[model samples]
Target: MLGLRPPPTAAAEYTLGSPRHPDVRVRVHWPTAQRPTPAETGGLPVLIYFYGGAWTLAGIDWLGWDRLFRERAVDAGVIVIAVDYSHAPEVQFPAQPEQGWTVLEWAHGAARELGGDLDRLAIGGASSGGNLAAAVALMNRDRHQRPIRLQLLEAPALDLTLGHVDAGGVNKAIPDVILRQMAARLVTQYLGTGRGLRRHPYASPMLARSHAGLPPAVVWTAELDPLRGDGEAYVTTLTRAGVPAVGVRMIGQTHTSGGLRSVVPAAEHLHRDVVSTCVPSTHRRWTIRIRCAPRTTGYEPA
Candidate 1:
């Protein structure tokens, strides 16, 4: 047992599990209303968000992600289905991605029961979570053709090979070489001994031969993050493939800055951007006027 205190509580939640994927646990967080129902709002959109932990650590119970998911459910007026997929090493490549696919399928199938709109279903993640989200979007396209309305990637580690990373950042306390080494180690841990798997498209979405047909994407990156290159390149490739994609960089912020929404003002923009972006573009619902902050690289859909 983890002799630790339980994490913060959400407004409402329920569990989803399957015998095939016993290790994975899916949690659906509801908005904080006394009697929340879809009748008033027509139906809420759904965001199946995956949290980041380099693909090897952390869970939905992580205080930062727990808080963020709760806020997103209320502000964005969408149901947040936070996935707790199994980590790497203990499991391996394909395992995590497959679990992600399963969760997406489940969410799509249960949308009506969850009081969610099928038209505005989206997949999102941060760092490693971003990688999984991208992979699942690809799977949804290739297999079932699920209507994934949007793909929100924040500081996503798209290229697990670490080829498209920026070595320099605002914080230089750790030398570039050490940072690279640490990142390399994390990649190794996720892939185990199967280093060739790094080149697989699902493992590294940036290396995918084609970025066409994926859902519209809102990619966010921290100016001081090494993963900035991955996020930006993803936007470039997606746009080139005739997909509508937007990339934004948070200036003066590091990789972890996004989790500081409660304390950092700039971080609040992250939440705001997510809330704004989640609004369906082609739907029959309401509209939200988006205004980008000065420090942020503006978000404009192509």
Candidate 2:
């Protein structure tokens, strides 16, 4: 349902792997400061990102990722590499995770080529893309790949089984039953016959047997989203496992609403804060101390 649009801003495109089960196409976004070479400032920080589409739709043109590409690069002075993983109905579950893994592995090993510092690599995404980001971190930890310094999950669908949803907190526009039905379709399309079979932790990360050793993360959730339960639950799991994890429940909003900066003030806060947290301030290139300045408890704006 998304149209093919050339990146509306300046970015370098590259093809990674093949077009089969796990091949991917990626774009590397750079801050427009000095146009420094790949290893600027002894290598700039890298943000490995995935776009949200419920493992079925969306690409770089999605409002969230596209906006980040157009505005954040210059302000943040960081490099963002977005992965275009193959969607479902044509591919399947493991394919998406495998593609995510391939991109992570390459990013971890080839940071210098992208004008990035391996030491500051972070991963993030919106919606299903958020799920994939968490899965990639899990895979990285399991595979002993370079540690992911931070993870940013926005309205992530962390649990595919989704038994934790109460639907009491969701918005009227997105009813609980309808959301559940959509989730069922997503899982069915991605897992196929595997629904009756085994559900891998990598596929449904919250279902993972453990959450220890995962990187610190900022889990952003919309108050009215069914996946809010999943993101909140994941934060608890990670925190209990000794990972420094924080959860932000965006009140009076639904899933992916934080990306709508033009309409919502809180959404702008979320979008800007996310981009800021992803990159180091020009003054402090090697140090990062992020503290949440939440507005208020309930729906009060910041």
Candidate 3:
């Protein structure tokens, strides 16, 4: 057990098991309501989030993510659970997805105890975390474990095979070659001795046998991002498979733009869109979708 820890106003570091069941750690952010609880929900809608870092602890020591999470919880009036999952290389591919699935299962079973509605569960993540979220959705779909409401994938690293990063365009952010190299090294480390696992659905959801029956997806991609093509393609696949999916490509932004909300307008808009998309509508159903033409093949403009 950890002795000294941060305060729990925005997020409380919660443990799933105390040397009983397999131990799992997470940071859960509970919302603030006017009354004792919201009317529509006897409990709060839970948004399980995974931070971006190629499955690594990127900013665990930093306070930025915690602040944004807290603000989003208050604004959206939902329980925000940010997972501090183990990193790759050390733990490898299957372990990452396996632990994520474990967290989702634990959250669903413990939702009521934590004052979160089991029926209103949503999952979201950024970058590599986004990839894991997508994998979890697909896992749930195949296993029929739980019904997920929405999947918010922000600049997800979907195609782990490494060739998809070379979009053959210049936008002034990280170059295609560097991005490709990074992906190659990361994939090598993640797969370790199991190189063929790259094509596995849990490792790369974009390479899934079918995109049918998965949860509705809200895909956020950056125009300059290397993974933009894969992210948008996943949206197209979902749409064609009859799932109501929307892909938003933020112009003049990079892969990690979702984390720069305070400085960039596009980033801030993405942040607001996430909060609004997860939160209940005051008037009618709220969504970030726009009417796309029949032949449109790319992302919807943001």
Which one is best on lDDT? 1
| lDDT of candidate 2 over 15-63, digit per residue (tens) | 7784356668887777763446664457887888888988888887566
Off by over 4 Å in 1: 1-22, 38-41, 170-173, 285-289, 292-302
What's the C-alpha lDDT at position 184 in model 2? 86
Candidate 1 on 12-108: residue-level lDDT in tens?
A: 4545554465456777876655435667556678899999998889898886677778778876667889999888777777888888888888888
- Each prediction's whole-model lDDT (CA): 0.81, 0.76, 0.74
What TM-score quantifies how close candidate 3 is to the native fold?
Answer: 0.83
The CA lDDT at 134 in model 3 is 94
- The candidate that wins on TM-score is 1
TM-score of each predicted structure versus truth: 0.87, 0.86, 0.83
Candidates in descending TM-score order: 1, 2, 3
RMSD of each: 5.5, 4.6, 7.1
Clashing pairs in 1: none
What are the runs in model 3 whose C-alpha is more than 4 Å off? 1-10, 17-22, 33-41, 59-61, 169-176, 281-302
- Ten-residue stretch with the least lDDT total in model 1: 1-10
